[model samples]
Target: MRRFAAAFAAMLATCPGLVHAAQPCLTAAEASSLTAYALPSAITGTAKRCVPNLGTNAFLPTGGAELAARYAVRKHQNWPAAKAAFLKMGAKDESSAFLANMPDPSLQQMLDALIEGMVAQQIPLDRCAEIDRVVGLLAPLPAQNTAELLAVMFGLAGKTGKAKNDLFSICES
Candidate 1:
């Protein structure tokens, strides 16, 4: 957990616009703004379908190293196909627009969760690739890029807090 936290801190340091005085959680105004851009039902529905397949074992802490290894392998194998899909989705431009429009910390955390969820699931490599690509594009922008990524991810992962558990399930067989 310390290692993950350290890595996350490092990520924040490298990425500008995300270095704000931390708040404990999202404010009502922030949540309301996020809801305004809520993901379409179709996308959220797909996430719901995918979640169960991840199973209860998906986010176990005991298999962290093994899960990380598997995720690396899956990411390597699927990145190309996923990149093509990302371009097809026109996420590149859309991502840039999202970054320009919204730069909130809550949204950034949402994006991080989404990406982490994708890495955990390791099945929908295409969407994972899209999120990864957008994240890269947002690297130079403000930290909100990360937030937008999470919002999209939440939309993809059923927009529920429970979906975060999927991040720990990566090592499940």
Candidate 2:
């Protein structure tokens, strides 16, 4: 999970205009929805990008497809709120006009591609083994549980002053 969090934080840091200190925050549910929708693809992309490092027998190379598939089942179900939460994270006044004017389908496509590309690029090869181990540990949990756990951990980080550099905030419940 540390690997996941570190990779996510690195990805967020590279995104321009995401540090909107005063932007409207996502609700806990919205945050969870976004995490649920995005996490599977992130993992899948990481696994694919790290295949050379992970080896054929690594859990990610062997079981990642199944794990990602399990999480994908709820992606459509989570999209609406996830989309809103994603927009909230990215949109920053006139700078985000391009995002605001894009149609939903186009926006979603861009977001999906961006997630895959960013995960593939951000995760360090040196950490692939640790990431593979962490994801394998997480694989036994239900998809929702994994997503919710991540959301809660992020939310707690924001709330407890641990997330000083987080890109966006979670709203108070």
Candidate 3:
């Protein structure tokens, strides 16, 4: 029975669902999402996680995710210091180094995730129903050619597809 228990523990260690919360504040998946080519190849796996205090907002930087966003961008220039800065910014304990090594663009995605995560934890994300509306309307348009996307955001008229969905279309005229 003792041997079986030990095997079970070992098995549990490799189980991601169990590890996601029990192991540390951050997850391996979160770590891998960060990629910084500037760092030495060997330092690509050092990261840790942090737990949030309930009923309070902790992750959102004072100026609306600027610190975290900048930290993400810093990977494009320097990463070691940036990682340290991230630590200083209340990231607490980091586990995987993968996040520190991700490129700047990926960091944008990371920041978005972090912001969205904090917001979701703090309030109902459905409050921002417009994002869904935007996605649904924009889905048919070519994302690669962001002219339509930008036009809508900036209230400037641009390209029109064959079937313009008024519910989705942004007419700037």
* Model number with the top lDDT: 2
Tens-place lDDT per residue, model 2, 83-170, is 7777777647664666667787887676666677778877888989988888899999988899888888877776777555264467
Compare candidates 1 and 3 on lDDT and give the better one: 1
TM-score of decoy 2: 0.83
- The reply for model 3, stretches above 4 Å from the true place, is 1-83, 87-94, 124-173
TM-score-better candidate, 2 vs 3: 2
Q: Give a tens-digit lDDT track for model 1, residues 1-173.
A: 11222233343333344433331233322322332232221123223334344334433222323333433333333333332222222223444345435544444445445544433333353443343333234334332333344434433343355443111111111
Can you tell me which runs of candidate 2 are displaced by over 4 Å? 1-24, 160-165
List, in order, the clash count of every candidate structure: 8, 0, 17
Question: Which RMSD does model 1 reach against the true structure?
Answer: 17.3
- Give a tens-digit lDDT track for model 3, residues 68-136: 333334344443333443322232234334444567467545543443333333322332233223323
**Estimated TM-score for each candidate:** 0.24, 0.83, 0.22
Pairs with steric clashes in candidate 2: none
145 Cα displacement, candidate 2 (Å): 1.4
Choose the strongest candidate by TM-score.
2
